[model samples]
Target chain A: MPVNKPFLHGQFAKRGIKAAKGITGIAVLFIAWQIGASVSGVSSYFFPAPVDVYNAFRDMMHKGILEVYLLDSLYRYVVGVFLGSLVGIGVALALGLNKAIAAVFAPLVGFFYAIVESAWLPVFVIWFGYGITTILTLLIFVVAFPILYNVLAGIQTLPIVYVNAARSLGATRWQILREVILPGVLPSIVTGFRIGAGFAFRGLIIAEAIAATSGIGFLIFDGAANKQTDRTIVGMIIMGLLWLIIELAYLRPFERATIQKWGLVTTAEQREVQ
Target chain B: MIVNKELPKISVDNASIAYTNQDFAEPHLAVKDVTLEVSANEFLVVVGPSGCGKSSLLAAIAGFLTPQGGSIKLNGKQIEGPGADRGVVFQDYALLPWKTVLDNVGLGLKFRGMSKAERDKIAREHLALCGLADAEAKYPHQLSGGMRQRAAVARTLANQPEVMLMDEPFAAVDAQTRMTLQEELVRIWQQTEVTVFFVTHSVEEAIFLGDRVMVLSSGPGEIKAMVDIDIERKDRDLSSLNSNPRFQALRDEITRLVRQDAA
Candidate 1:
């Protein structure tokens, strides 16, 4: 009647345990880093202590530098990832639905996939120059590739039964794409999103460090140049925490609700072997 | 509705299907020169050994495979591809896992441009008919194997297809559940004037459920024999299937034909 309440309750309990483990794991790492710094007798500039880093975080927060940089980095990341994933999924559907178009783009996609992010960086800088345009463009370019590959893979890996059953039910081509293909590929889309989000984070930092004037990446660089190691350490910790929070709060729950929880759609590569 | 009692619903005329290969491997022949006919509203069951190409034959009828040799026709019109008039229940109950039972059942209706409320109402009716009254909101994975198959059946029935193609729809279920589903399927078949082409490996199941049973030979499947059960007019009693003398005779005859691999 209600789709098995006990299973849902059990999943909740498992999630609690997983969250506890994650918290404990982060706490242990922090403690180890503090101990290692103290034992090595490293200068505060070389390796700032936990308290020093915490104080730096507090000072930056008070001065509002942290807030501006954090917001700047997050805004770029959010917009870039969203735009890139949209383009990626669009291309994937194109390739998936039609073989002739896929044949034409297959080699191009492969070649572009082989090109490194840095390879495009130099040319992009020349075209867009050092500013939000260059950074945003670079971030989107880098983020879109992985999602494109992943979504394409998702499309290819879809079960044949889904298509056959839908067609048998008299679904037209467009109807099949919307009703069957879209839902079938969503699990892989989310997987690609997680992977692409990770790439976006790295791309954001790199783009900021090289092209933009303010961001977490800029903070790390600015601190090093200005001999504010504590601020750099603060930046590093925030980046890790931000990614961790996003993963736990958004990506994971979305996956759980859509794919893993539904218990259908393997989305794994093995299903595509045929 | 294509409900003409005198016309054959689907006709297979000397159709042969071969699977081609791109590599050095030899192309395989799955079904060879198979011929059969299903009249309107007839529940025709097909039984054969493994690798008999029963599934391939069914797929050809569903328009997933094209015949290399002859042709298939529906209502005197040569079959081109899959259509709404012919609904298929796959061996593995191909319910879209993302959708709830209600959504999956109403999927065909959605394609037909029925409003959501009307589709859901029709879906609910079929679900109830299949003894899944309370499972309309449950996702496919949430249901047991028997329930999943039932939902698949309901989904097909809701589409109101003229011909129902079932590829061993109960093979995945346990014996008890299979028997129950078989009985339920018979009851549903009797209620509607829909023709059914059911494929199964079990002789007992074929005899218990079919008005006529078609037996196919192994490897590159061809018709071995076609047996009329003659029990369609009798009281349908699945529980006494094993003990019924006529049921046993039919089962034995079909089993013997299958064991010989030819009539």
Candidate 2:
């Protein structure tokens, strides 16, 4: 046991270091691919070399094409998520607060949630025509369901004592929602938002590619049509990079901070102490 | 029988509680035909074995559960729903996890429509009184078991309820912490003049804390015996009272009553 104690601690340290290296190793692989492509002298026709894509990226930036498309994509993403989240949360809260509302809407939300967001693209395009309205609405509809459903469940599942305590202290229904229910459901809502954002991003890109032009999606599709693989590669790279930035630099950090601050993630020790 | 003629802060008259769920063969009768009068500012502790309906009586007083028969009147106003006039400290701390200690304490004040500053001031006073001033910014999870219960006490106390109904509030804490909390509670009750109707399973806790201890019989629970502690309120600290022969006698008597009721 004495020998095994040090061995186990050492094993843990080694595993921690390996996990860190593995993450950086993935970035290293991407760098290696870029170098290999540039050095191999592969003509820009086939898998367009990394330098070719970089040049294409630079040209688009210089022409202000990149900025315009990026801004448009961002706008759609933000607006769609915001509007979708509002409706989803509102409906979820309504359902969570009243059983009658839940009985009426839960099945409807469940059925729609099972249907993929892309399935609506064709109908939306037919109804609204190939425009921002169709894309944004589709994205919102996709994102809204998950957020509402998860939030509703989370709010409903709160320990009965929490509400009873509040009511005993003279908290009105509104106060209970604002003070207790909202905070209780927030982490799950964020989880739903993360899931929703992934879908919205996918939906936005698909919508852009299928119809009117002006996004990273359009950039890739148009580049492929024109047989400019360099442009296509650059578009793909930018899409990955931007989504990574949003997810890691923005969304992940926000979620982590929120969970740290207000999360009810409890351990056995904390429960015992409390 | 010269019942103390002081105005009853709470009057329970032939109250019986039965759960109205559909699946049961018979409605679960938690308490049956129980009547007691809690005097103004009196520390009345009800003790019984598990399932003896001590907590049910407290719940009825708190208006969390409606009695199927008879009534509970606070100064003769029938309690139809929960009100701020009667604060409750549950066995489980029940502090809102998302709320800071200060916010949790001030929750009732917020409902009363007090200004943030006013609520903060009152919350701070109660927090300080509960010896939790340093923990005002902490969440319930960060606090110790004793601290959380103290915070609960502070939260209830901050509401300034005329009658405080505590359902085994110290049961969740350890023995040492429990003893400390009992002393603090007694001190608070003395200072505030708030009537406390406490329910406990422990006979020693009942005898140590209560001005009058009521030993309740099991299921369809009734008051089997009542003993009034004549110890001077100021001298009734946990240590001094634990060693007091009369405290021991009352504890033994209540223990015997509860055990006999259990049999």
Candidate 3:
């Protein structure tokens, strides 16, 4: 079999435009930061210039603090995302397949959904005691809700004809679930996961700062307290770089491979008109 | 056209259907006291107006919808549910968006527990018959509207169903494509021994494709007329069929019956 290109059909040029725009934005920000610092005549200890922040990042790298922090933060975030998605999709599929389960869980889940993950932090802190466990729980809670709702909404939006067609073609219940239902809701599931992951990312920073002793969030809080504002700026830069890497390496490529390739999943707006 | 008086492939005895999901207080009755007997190898075309319950009738036969009253049977046995023995082609084509043409055609047989190699051979043959010979690897979205519908027909046929239920299968295409598809359907029908129950809203389409066209009234679809096309099977070509007087007569009759009662 022939191997297809990872980025085919002019996708390289498509993403290139986005990448160029993003890089330009950062470049302009950095240039302005340098001019602003000189113009303001502010102390570097209060707000670090781009060059000062870069020096602090290098200094931290040499001391191996930033490397260890990066690993710790990434580990918790990745594991939390994985577990949360699995549970969310599993629960959604279970509820979607049975009306009784949906009816029983709908209001209960909705009630819990209204209570933000941040609200659970104080309670989780009491339970898990200000460590990876508390922070991870908050991350999972943040990620799972959006994924669960998206999966449920996706299953509901599917047209009945797809199921009817497959059934008439001699598919059993299991076959319908596997072949028709799963594939039909996949775009929505992925879309939901993306939204959930984005929400969880914001929650991750807050959770890490309050709970964990290691991680970029820990570094930011620690820098603010110890009069190391340059290190705080370094942590911020790393966070931005991490996000860019995740999108370019994971989410964008994953979407390109599946949803964009199929081009069949219509959004809610497109579906209404159709 | 002489429909052989052999065993009936499908028999709908006094079937009635109603849509109960509407917000209105009264249930909307679709078809009432409708009974149909389609024999083996018979090409039966059902024609009706917009509000007619022709689709509901077809759906009941395909085991997608249940009749409010009466029973539907296949070869003297009751149809418990949807089975591999009866295949349906939907108006949207219902081709799996993710699957390629070859895979979609072979999928029905796969569900019947047929080996991959065996189903693939059967699928390839049917795809060729439907004039989709070289397009097996292409996805449904890659194909034209006409090609997608043809693939749908091929997929249903490859299942080797005794009866093929088609509900407005060509209604989504353009006029040019619709005519070509109607012609292709006739050619394919002649090549296979399977019985077909095709429902359409077009009067001319009914005359062109069906061995016997059955017309139903507007609402609560009741059989208003059944006309047997006397034209030879070979004369169904668009060029020749246009000039055929009997074909025109049948079209006019079905049109009048469908447009009856100011509907």
Candidate 4:
């Protein structure tokens, strides 16, 4: 009859099994890849085995190339995403609060959102010219639109009752904005941030490939150009692993602390029913 | 018992409410030429059928809507907009999901720039008053409908408003919970001097909770009748009221008035 204790244990057991299955899957893939490369008789440059890629990873770590490139990539990602998210939230609140301003700018924001971030990159490179400025601009552009759109959507869907309740509770306009509007739209802001962060990650790699002399994007590109295929494979693996870390460590915890804790997801579902 | 010892707390004269629908060129009139006065500390209940503008009338008093034709005044001051002087308890229990029950109750004090320690102390007192002392740290989503409404009531009461505007506050809860809440509300009203203006569609609710019930006719709502209940305050519980002759007569008369408008 004690449901909670057993349910918690069951959750832990389920997680353990899932982790074990994931490790097994990777082990199987690595063994198959190693065997296939050895039997194929192709040059390791063309089809490097898992062990060769591991060697290249060790080689880069010894030479400090991986550390430097990773730091550079992380710096760009943090600065770009932070600035973009601020701008997106700011513009969203400005337009969302005022009808006249929203009417004037909503269409323009939509028009820009329609154009892909990649298209803007060439123009950014032309304007800022092949450096951190161009890359940062591209990353910011990629991150802002999704966040802006989602936050606007959040503002639109927010219930009027919350505002009315706050007003009657003696909240000033500024107090309402701080206490009511911002918190009400927080779930949407988190959703937008997740999407924007993904787009920024991809944009960083592409921008570095085209514009920068450093970062993981450059490492991957330069490796393939110099016929160091194992190093290219190492860079690709790092990219995938880095994203997993960001998702699990940063995004998921943020969601767990805020939106999930507030039970806004269930609240949204209830609103839909109404 | 203290119905008219002083000036009327809220006065409305020839108030009309209309709404402009995008699809319709003509503005839909919800309430027309309504005039009413609520005395200090009076428990006034507005009861009517659907589309009777009972809610519109409450909204006007709460300052969410401005009466197009006439004026609504509170304590001889024109009601310009919403203020802490007049707190509203909504039907949906508009406690912020992100805030704990204590924080929601303390929100008005927070807006007044009260210290967290001071606000929390006051908030806890109100939570205890509402029988929600154990639920102070729980979020709104964690509370049941009745509890949520109770928290909302505590929230408005904590703000120390002169008048409490309740727009069908207990309508969303189950039948049993509604009865319990109604009794608790009557008890709470007795403890505080805050005047109550409650709106509902249930005639039984009107009779059991209100000192006087004002019934409104159907759309473009006008006052159909005003009935004063003679049941003793001590006999206004679900069990006692079920057999009280005065309670039954008032319920029947108000039900007939509401049904006539619906018909």
Q: Name the best candidate (by TM-score).
A: 4
Clashing residue pairs in candidate 4 are none
DockQ of each: 0.73, 0.56, 0.66, 0.85
Superposed model 3: Cα runs more than 4 Å off: A1-18, A265-274, B1-5, B23-25
Residues B1-263, candidate 2: write the lDDT tens digits: 55455668899999998764576678888888988998899899998889888888888888889999899999877889788899999899899877899999999999889999999999999999999999998888888999999999999999999999999998878999998898888888888979999999887888778889888889878878888977777666776777888777877777788899685
Q: TM-score, each model? A: 0.91, 0.89, 0.93, 0.94
Question: Candidate 4, after superposition: displacement of residue A29 in Å?
Answer: 3.1
lDDT of 4 at B237: 69
lDDT of 3 by residue, A22-76 (tens): 8899899999999998788899998778888889999999999999999999999
**In angstroms, how far off is B231's CA in candidate 1?**
2.0
Candidate 1 chain B least-lDDT 10 residues: B19-28
Output the number of the DockQ-best candidate. 4
Task: Classify candidate 1 by CAPRI docking class.
Answer: medium
DockQ order, best first, reads: 4, 1, 3, 2
Q: Residue A103, candidate 3: how far off, in angstroms?
A: 1.3
Q: What is the DockQ of candidate 2?
A: 0.56
Give the clashing pairs for model 2.
Answer: none
Q: What is the TM-score of chain A alone in each candidate?
A: 0.90, 0.83, 0.90, 0.89
RMSD of 1: 3.6
Which has the higher lDDT value, candidate number 2 or candidate number 4? Answer: 4
Q: Candidate 1, residues B1-263: lDDT per residue as tens digits?
A: 74576768899999997776474277668889988889998999988888888888888888888889999999978888898899999989999998999999999999999999999999999999999999987899999999999999999999999899999899899999998898899889999988999999888888888889998899888899999988755555876667878777887888999999743
**Docking band of candidate 2:** medium
Better of 1 and 4 by TM-score: 4
